[model samples]
Target: MLLAMDRVTSYYGKTAILKDFSFGIEEGKCLCVLGRNGVGKTTLMRTIMGLTDRSIGDITIKGTEIGSSPTHVRAKLGIGYVPQGRGILSEFTVRENILLGTFARHDGRPDIPEVCLQMFPYLKANLDRRAGLLSGGQKQQLAIARALAVDPKILLLDEPTEGIQPNIVHEIGETLMTLNRKLGITLLLTEQHIRVARRLGDAFLMVDNGRVVASGPMAQLTDDVIHHYLTI
Candidate 1:
C-alpha cells in the first residue's frame, strides 16, 4: 500500500470523532471518502495529515509509520493535503502561494511548476495575481496547485468541489483523473458528490458519525448502502 491507516482514531479536544477507522490506497489509485455533512469526512483527512492529532491507531506511508510526525514532517514524507474551503491566501500572488508549498519540501523536483501548470492552466496565466481575488474555482485550482508543488506521493483532498459551479466541478474531476492515471499519484478525496465519486474513484469509503460504516469498490456502491448512510 502506498498509504495505509490502521485503527485510526481522532479527537477534537475532548470529543472523539473517528473510531478505529482504517483504509488504504495504492500508488496510482484514487480513493474517495463519501458521506453527508459533519460525518467525520474532514476529520479523517485531517487525522491522516496530522492536522488533528490522533488519539489512537497508526498511519503509515510507503511503509514508514508516521503516527507521531508533525504536519511539516508529513509533507516532506510525501503527503500533500488540500484542506476544505481551498485555503488559498487572498493577499498573496499565485506564484507566492505555490512557493509556500515548496518551502518545507526540500526535494526540489524541478518539473513541479510545469506539472502544476499543466493541471491548472488558469494559474499559469495568473501567476502574479492575488489568490484571494480569484474566483472560487480559480482559488480551488490554486489550492490544488500548491499541494502538487510539493511533489507528493499521495494527494489528500477535502471536498475539492464544495461550492464550485458545475462546469468547474467537472474540470476538477478531469484533472484528478488525469493526475491519477498519468502522474501515478494516489488521490484520497473526501467529497459529497456521489456522481463525481462514482466516475473518478477506484474504491470508496463511507463514514457515519466518525466511523467507517462501509467501504468497497465504487462498482459495489449498492443502492441500499447509499440510501442508508450516504444520503441525508
Candidate 2:
C-alpha cells in the first residue's frame, strides 16, 4: 500500500473526529473519499498529514509507520497536501508559495520543480505576483503546483473543487487526471461532487459520522449505496 490507516482515531482538542477509521490506497491509484458535510472527510486528510491536535493508531506509507511522526517528517516521507481552501500564503508571491513545499524535500533543493511550472503556465508567467490576487481557480492551481514541488509519492487533496466555477472545476479535474493517470502519482481526495469522484477515482470510501460506512472499487459504488449514505 502507498498509504494506509489502521484503526486510526483522530482528535481535535479531546474531541475525536475520526473514530477508529481505517482505509488504504495502493501506489499510483486514485481513491475518493465521499461524505456529507461534517462527516470527518477533511479530518481524515488532516490525520494522515498529522495536522490534527492528536491521533492514535497506525498510519503507514510503503510499510513504514508514520502515526507518531511530526508533520514535517510526514511530508519528507512523500506526502503532499493541498489543503481545503487552497491554503496558499496571501502575502507571498507565487514563486515563494511554491518554494515553501520544497522545504520538505529530502533533496533540500530550493528551486521549484520544473513540473510545477509546466503544469500551470499561468503561474509560471506570474511567478512574482502576490498569491492573494489570483482568482479562486488560479489559487487552486497554485496549491496543486506547490504540492507537486514536494515530489510526493501520494497527494492528499481536501475538496479540490470547492467553490469554483464549473468550467474551472472541469479544468482542474483534467489536471488532476493527468497527474494521476499520466504521471503515475497516487491521489487521495475528498470530493462532494459525485460526478467528479466517479470520473477520477478507481476506488471509493464512503464516510459518515466519522466512520467508514461503505468502501470498495468504484464499480461497487452503486446508486443504492449513494442514496443511502451520500444523499443530503
Candidate 3:
C-alpha cells in the first residue's frame, strides 16, 4: 500500500474531527474521499500530512511508520499536498511558488523541475507573474504544479475542482487524470463532484461524521450510496 490509516483519530484544538478513520490506497490508484460539507474530509487529508493539532493511530506510507513523524518529514517521504483553497502565496511570483515545493527534496536543489514547466505552459510563460493576479483556474493549476514540483510518489488533493469556472473544471479533471493514469502518480483526492470522482478514481471512500461509512471499488458506488452519504 502507498498509504494506509488504521483507527486514526484527529483533532483541532480540543474538539475532535476525524474519529477512528481507517482506509488504504495502493501504490498507483486514485482514492476519492466523499462527504457532505464539514464532515472531516479536509481533516482527513490534514491528518495524513500531519497538519492537525494532534492525531493518534497508525498512518503508514510505503510500509514506513509516519503516524508520529512531523509534517516536513512526511513531505520528504514523498507525500505532496495541494490543499483546499489553493494555498499559494500571493506575494510570490509563479516561479517562486513552485520553487517552494523543491525545499522538501532530498537533494536540496533549488531548481524548478522541467516537468512543471512542460505541464503548464501558461505558468512557464508567466514565470514572473504574481500568483495573486491569476484567475481561479490558473491558481489551481499553479497549486497542482507546486505539488508536482515535490516529485511525489503520492498526491493528496483537497477539492481540486472547487470554485472554478465550469469549462475549466473539466480541464482540471483531465489534468489530474493524466497525472494519475499516464504519469503513474498515486492520488488521494477529496472531491465533491461525482462525475470527477467517477472518472479519476479506481476506488472510493465515503466519509460521514468523521468515519468511513462506505468504501469499495468504483463500480460499486451506486446511486443509493450517492443519495445516502454524498447528496445534501
Residue pairs with backbone overlap in model 3: none
- For all predictions, the C-alpha RMSD in Å is 1.4, 0.7, 0.7
Q: Score each candidate by Cα lDDT.
A: 0.87, 0.96, 0.94
- For candidate 3, the TM-score is 0.98
State the lDDT of candidate 3 residue by residue for 58-134, as single tens digits.
99999999989999999999999999998999999999999999998766778999988988999999999999999
Clashes of each: 1, 0, 0
**TM-score of candidate 2 to 2 decimals:** 0.99
lDDT of 2 by residue, 1-232 (tens): 9899999999999899999999999999999999999999999999999999999999999999999999999999999999999999999999999999999998899999999999999999999999999999999999999999999999999999999999999999999999999999999999988899999999999999999999999999999999999787
Identify the superior model by lDDT, candidate 2 or candidate 3: 2
TM-score of each: 0.96, 0.99, 0.98
Q: Residue 197 deviation, candidate 2, in Å?
A: 0.6
